[model samples]
Target: MSTTQSDRLRGLLEPLVDAKGLDLEDIELSRAGRRRMLRIVVDSDEGLDLDLCAELSREISDKLDETDVMGEDEYQLEVSSPGADRPLKEHRHYVRAVGRLVKFQLAEGGDLVARIVDVDDEGLDLEVPGVKGRKPTARRIAFTEIAKARVEIEFNRKDKKEEEA
Candidate 1:
């Protein structure tokens, strides 16, 4: 999609998302078979649910139908939250992943899998799990050192409180 079109869509939809207590994370316009697809990814600190997505979809469809921005083109609108494994790009993404395990690809050429204990402007405070019956150790990683990061799914992970108890 053209930058101009994308900008226009963001400008139009951002306020709507914000008013509903969510952040508009991404907007994509792509081709799906013979029709165009407009995918809107939104999120909040409180998280998202199917009912919320449905509500936002209706609001977005109404806005698009009444506006001239889409120019009467046939397109399908999809409103969704970012998937669990989506890359952590922005500072807010890292903040939201606290208490969850993440896999990081270091710019210095190595990988680290750890749980985020805290986050700040400079970097992250991670709890790296130790092997061979060792205790988990605390570590820090600067933002500049990370090439990529994404949350890792844990099927049988226990909450910190549960472990402590």
Candidate 2:
């Protein structure tokens, strides 16, 4: 598939995400039935909330409508946060995920979870635990070996406490 359209969609969404201090996780702008589906998955360093989703959806939809980026046909735009199971890729992906716990299945067939200690154009340097004594070890996984990676939701005490507090 020509990723040009997809890139264009990302270019379109960047402004809104930047304005709100949110990271654009992923975007799939394509045709689904009679309308196009503009799936924007966003997140933040802290996390995501219902309010954020609503705000982004409203603002992004208005901008898209104003710009007419989708051409003549009507389209369905979905602005959502990537949630806990969201994948990690790209420089911005790792940048947003810095200090967050993440899990990924290695190409050789083992899963690892660790805090993202650092990320750069070079690769992902994670603070993973050692298998033996549970020592904190920094493992630099090359971007090529990263078949899959996602933010791991270790716990949601804040979201829960808000329901109580």
Candidate 3:
């Protein structure tokens, strides 16, 4: 991994994302032979759509190309939304996933699968998405205990209503 190049790109992307009111999920810089790859993942308030990604990709690609940041090579620029299975590391990840199903590993070596109810300064509140006959159970989880947290793509009954509207 080219750490310096990646960091340089991060510096360039941060303000661009903020100015557009979008979150930068991740970035990757790779080179194979004479080709280079610059991938950027993004998310927004209305959720990520193909159109939005394409637009952002074109804009960023143009800017990057102008700067010659990827070096003089045939580079493929790919930009898209973070997949549903993306891990939620930051607090903002949970907030953006309020109506989505998620799975998180506990510090005690256990895991929880539930629908994220909300995210606040304190922590994330997730409601167990109807485990068989069991009703939704809300759990307040702190950041320290979150060993692994990622969005779950499977259908969750609890989030159905929210997704409908």
Query: What are the Cα lDDT values of the candidates?
Result: 0.94, 0.79, 0.80
Question: Model 3: runs farther than 4 Å from truth?
Answer: 1-3, 129-132, 156-165
The residue-level lDDT of candidate 3 at 123 comes to 82
| TM-score for each candidate, following the candidate numbering | 0.92, 0.63, 0.84
Alpha-carbon lDDT of model 3: 0.80
Candidate 2, residue 19: Cα displacement in angstroms equals 0.8
Candidate 2 per-residue C-alpha lDDT over 125-145 given as tens digits, one digit per residue, 9 for 90 to 100: 889867878779878887777
Q: Show how many residue pairs clash in every candidate, following the order shown.
A: 0, 0, 0
Identify the superior model by TM-score, candidate 2 or candidate 3: 3
Q: What would the TM-score be for candidate 3 when compared with the true structure?
A: 0.84
Name the best candidate (by TM-score).
1
Predicted candidate 3 versus true structure: per-residue lDDT over 1-165, tens digit per residue: 556877888888777777777988888878878788888988876687777777788778777877856777788888888877888887777887887888889888988888788788878787886768878877888888789988877653455566678
